[model samples]
Target: MKKTIFLFAILLFISCKKEETKNESLYPEAEKSAEEKQLELGQAIFEGKGNCFSCHKPDQKIIGPSIQEIAVMYKEKNGDMVAFLKGKAEPIVDPSQYEVMKTNFAITKNLPEEELKALEAYFYSFAK
Candidate 1:
């Protein structure tokens, strides 16, 4: 009985290892490019701590402008999103919404530069 249990345990461990290897090959996390990683970081911030999804959505406008609109306008104007997030530049998409957005600056302005850049990259990902 002891030998049988040991064998089953060994088989289970081996199977788990094989499954992990297969999943790793399929996902290939290490193969992700810098831009992909940046996008992911930005997405996380947008959906998570940034609470951006509460206002700015990916497509249509919600409380503020849509992500696509912001991206398109920024690209056309060559605006620096990072600067705007950092509270250095003024809002260009919807100045009327600045007061509402200003309340979030306390959260955004405190974020690290890398995180801010990642947010910009994420936003631009929706650009046409």
Candidate 2:
């Protein structure tokens, strides 16, 4: 009976984890001033420090979707991209591509709010 109870608890935990992962990319909200600055910083980080541009880009897909495409999806979902940087959000948009992104998962699994926000801004900036 204890074994059965433990299994049930594990399933419950997995279910909750999936839900939390789905919403990982969202931010609380953003002010215009902060967003602009974050975006600029994000661009530098993504292209330079993050090295995301190798697999991803502002307007075209490399190994991953373009930043503009990501922005469009984020806008539609009304979700937070920040969660993604923290390894929270799942690859719902492109499950097949998850394998390609999996390698970078460890690096982005834990990021500061500022860095994630800046990355979001950088990605969203390409939508225009």
Using all chains and alpha carbons, the TM-scores for the candidates as numbered come to 0.79, 0.66
Candidate lDDT values, in order = 0.94, 0.77
- Which regions of candidate 1 deviate over 4 angstroms? 1-27
Q: List the residue pairs that clash in candidate 2.
A: 24-83, 25-80, 25-81, 25-83, 26-80
Candidate 1, residues 47-110, lDDT tens digits: the string is 9999999999899999999999999999999999999988899899999889998888899999
Model 1: residue 34 alpha-carbon error in angstroms: 0.6
How many residue pairs of model 2 clash at the backbone?
Answer: 5
**Please, what are the lDDT tens digits per residue for candidate 2 over residues 1-128?**
99999999999999999878666746624424676667778878887868898988767877898878888887878767778667788765567888778777566665667787888777777765
TM-score, prediction 2 = 0.66
Residue 38 local lDDT, model 1: 99
